[model samples]
Target: MKNFSDIQIGNTIGPREQFVSKDECRAFAHSSGFAAPRFTDDEGARKEGLPGMILPGNMSLGLLSKFVTDWIGPEGGAQLVRISTTYRVPVQPDHTLVFQGFVTHSVPEERTAEIDVWIENEEAERLVTGTATVRFDK
Candidate 1:
């Protein structure tokens, strides 16, 4: 686990891959209350002006959040203060998603850090982009 003192500006966490299966997409849709056709049904998605069944913004945020939590370790190590994301493209099901991060700022005195986070498709197209702020434990 990376500690607060170990954080450095421009340090990147990953280009790690996660394959989002159709089943996983459907599961997230059901569990997260994003049962919109755009998320659950391909035909419904097309009717809704989407290319096909897609992942919800919240689900994508969860993926990014998990990435952060995994990086800085357990709750005792650091707490995620905030995260914000902008969806650029519909995250389709059954694609390998690439998660990435860059430490943009760190304040040792305040025990805080900010990371630029993103998720990209196998084609390297960015699906979500955001910044996450973390508060380190004393």
Candidate 2:
């Protein structure tokens, strides 16, 4: 677990990868109340001019959150305070998305850190980009 003192600006956090599966997309759609056919059915997605069934944007955010929290560790005494994201492209199933994050700034007085995060496809095209703020109590 990294304490507030251990976190520093310009620290690279991760390059974790997750394989997006059809079933997982379907499950996320069902659970998230997102009934968009593009997220559940490839044929429907094709009809909409998409490459294939796509994962929900929020699911991608969840992946980013996991990447950050995992890096901070359970005892890191850190909690996410804010996050903003922009989706650059449709994320389709069967693709491996690599998640990466880097600490961009920190405020020791507030025990806060600002991070830049992104997810890219196997071909290295960025699919999502975001900034996150986390606060550490310890």
Candidate 3:
């Protein structure tokens, strides 16, 4: 686990990659109550003019959140305060998505840090972009 002091502004963390699969998308859609055919059925997605089955936006956001927390670890004493994301393009199954982050700002007095985060596909197209704020306890 990295402590608050270990985090430096402008430092990059992770290019954690995950290959999205159809089954995973289906499960995420089913469990999240987002029963959209585009998220679970390739044919349905094509009918809707999509390339193939796509993952839910929230699922992608969850991946981004996981990337941050995973880097900090449970004992890092960092509490996520806020996060906001914008989906630029759909993420389809079979694509490898890479999650990465940059420490944008830090306030030592508040023991807080702000990070700029994003996810990119194998083709290097950005799928999601966001910012997160985490406060660390002394």
Candidate 4:
């Protein structure tokens, strides 16, 4: 079981093996109750000057959370205490996004760690920035 200290500054966890397809986006939107037209209809998205079906913001956030969770292991292994983020751009359906992060701070005695997160496309342009805190019980 990995813990907070296991992750290192400048070390990245994943460009997890998943693709953000239109179908995947729609499914996530449906399951998440995100009913915006841009999230479901390509034409609607085009009208809004977007390329195609837009992924729900929560899905993007969930992906980032999963990357962090996978790095720290199971929920009981290290609990996520806080996360703050800002979406800088949209993730269209074609690119392979690399979700990356680094350890920003640590308090060994308190068993807590802070990490900064960012996601980039195949082109390497950052799309999101976030900060998170996790607590290691063990």
Candidate 5:
């Protein structure tokens, strides 16, 4: 198990790129019950002046959560007690999505910490930003 305290503030966790495919987007849209044409149809998105098909905001956060969980592992489970995020830009299915996070603050007595999270592209342009509270206890 990795120690959460060892991770420093402003440290980048992952630039792990994930390609959001059309089939994946459609499946997610259906599963999430999101009926927005921007997330479903390429033509609709283009007509709306968007680049292409857009991914759901929650889906991006879901990817972030997965990254956190994987980092924390079994013996060191991080309970995501709270999260605050803003979608700065649309995530196109054709582009690679990067999930990155950093330790912002630590409260050892409370066995909790705050982390700033973001998703960016290869060019390092931030598409989303957020804060997350993680609880570490045995």
Candidate 6:
């Protein structure tokens, strides 16, 4: 939103795509202190009964944040004050992830709003769900 007043309940951002290869996820895991084997190696993930190396929960959250920010654009007038997410499935590497969000509540007087967000795979499986509070600076 260019201004806080532009926000309306039920207004949506996107079903935008975010993709990461095994190399990218591994690089993120290693740098961010989440470099456990299951997140770094397919073999290690198999040992844990997973099909392959997967992104950790924190990485998923970061991707969610990126989605919101990208939607807000470069000259953002909104500040994501708070965000909470629940992970439902493992986010696999080299996959097309979709990020979508909608406003659930709006407080125009306070210049704040609550947004519901979710990330799904190409197959339409929800990998994570979350809510965020954003304040707009006029």
Which candidate's TM-score is highest?
2
Candidate 5 global CA lDDT score: 0.79
| lDDT per residue as tens, model 1, 5-111 | 87788999897899998788889989987688888889999998988899988999999999988887664578888999999988998889999999999888988
Candidate 4 local lDDT, 1-22, one digit each (tens): 8765576656655655466777
| Error in Å for residue 80 of model 6 | 0.8
After superposition, candidate 2 runs with Cα above 4 Å error: none
lDDT of 2 by residue, 15-87 (tens): 8888878999899999999779999999999999998899899998888888888887877678898889898
Q: TM-scores for all candidates?
A: 0.93, 0.95, 0.93, 0.87, 0.87, 0.94
**Each model's C-alpha lDDT?**
0.89, 0.88, 0.88, 0.78, 0.79, 0.88
How does model 2 score by TM-score? 0.95
Range of the 10 consecutive residues with the lowest summed lDDT in candidate 5: 1-10
Report the lDDT tens digits of candidate 6 across residue range 24-114.
Answer: 8998999898699989999999999999999988888998887777777888788888889999998899998899999899887888889
- Give the lowest summed-lDDT range of ten residues in model 3: 71-80
Model 5 stretches with alpha carbons more than 4 Å out: 3-7
Candidate 1 versus the native: TM-score?
Answer: 0.93
Runs with alpha carbons beyond 4 Å of true place in candidate 4:
4-8, 15-17
State the lDDT of candidate 5 residue by residue for 1-138, as single tens digits: 655566566766676778778878888888999858899999999999998888888887777777777657766656878878799988877778788888878887877778888889878899988888888763
Most lDDT-accurate candidate: 1
